[model samples]
Target: MATASVVVPAREEAARLERTLASLGRQSFDGRLEVIVVASGAATLRIAREHGVVDRVLTDDRRDGPGAARNRGAAVATGDVLLFTDADTIVPSTWVRRHWRHYATPAVVGVGGPLRPLADGLSHRVRFRLLSDWWYRISWSVGFVQQPGPNCSVRRSAFEAVDGFDESLPFLEDTDLSLRLREAGRVAYDPDCPVRTSVRRHEREGYLPLLLAYLVGYLEYALPGRSPTREHFS
Candidate 1:
């Protein structure tokens, strides 16, 4: 069995971080699973420290971005597979196992799963089903694979080959990494290994504005000669 490292990047996620860590503790994977939390705020660090399931905790005082935080966690990880997920997401018990199974294929470099809404609100469900579920499926079918940060995993060798996520990209760094990973090998989509992610951002920032921001970011990433700005999202 291949060892795996689960990297979670957190900011001021005191209220939600515990749940994520607890969910990780329940993973049914048979291989050695290392859970690392890269946190920015004091409260987030405290919560991570209190979580007995966490194997390591690294502080990111720079508050650069999730991409940078994930990079820091990935740097010290000693696993064959590096799994990336948000502190606001709750993964299923078989999440790590499902991701690890894909690595049995030597040509598969990365695997991305679906993100279901944690909140039961109608709008939340609709947004996830449309924007996340359907979107990932269709895009992968067309050879334009994209892995959302909240639920994705990649082989450490391929990840290192591509030099990891672009810290310079504030919003669509995951998508950018997915595009580059295609050069290394195949990037796959696994719809069965779904993770439940918080919809608090949409609730706080409003649905249309958040959607529009991602749309613009996607366009900027897809179109030629256009660079991604340093615009931050929270």
Candidate 2:
């Protein structure tokens, strides 16, 4: 088993972070795993340690967006593979193992799994269908893109080559980074491996605008090569 670090980005997420940790503790890999929580204000150290996280709890006082925090976590991590996820997500038992398995081949620079909404709704269904169509296509599509961060991983070397996650463009940084990665190396999707994700967006804002907003954001970047704004994350 290779050394893997689970980098979870959280912001005032103490309540849900435990579920992520519990999910991580159950991974099937059985290797030396370290849980790196890149957070600020959300003191997850006690909960992470309580859940038996292998490495020291990490944080960024600057409170930069999740991208910045993830970069911070990656800098301190001592793993060959870097897995990026959200603190609100729940990883399946085989989450780490399945992700690590793909790296057996060198060309596989990026690997992503299913991002299933924890709760179902009309919004989730509509968006999920569109997303699935995008990711399953033999080739990448302009309007359709998949960079499901919660279940995505890449080799530490490749990540370093690309300079980890982009600190600019606070929102949709994964999309920005994945675009560069897909160009440099291959991005893989695991049909069998999926991770549980929160439906907070639906819970807060209804689905239609989000779908449209995402399209607008993607188009904004695609046509002009301009990164999205910080407020986009909100």
Highest TM-score: which candidate?
1
Cα RMSDs, all models: 3.6, 4.1
Clashing residue pairs in candidate 1 are: none
CA lDDT of each candidate?
A: 0.90, 0.75
Off by over 4 Å in 2: 42-45, 120-145, 228-234
**Runs in model 1 lying further than 4 Å from the true structure:** 228-234
Q: Candidate 2 residues 1-234, lDDT tens each?
A: 469988988777878888888888788886788778876553565566556654666656788788898898889988898898898899899999999988888888888776777777766765665564344443343423356778788888888988888887766778766666765677777878878788887568766787678778766765533753322222
Cα distance off (Å), candidate 1, residue 30? 0.5
Residues 110-194, candidate 1: write the lDDT tens digits.
9999989998888788888888889889988877788999999999999999899898887788988887898789998999989
TM-score of each: 0.94, 0.87
TM-score of 1: 0.94
lDDT of 1 at 75: 97
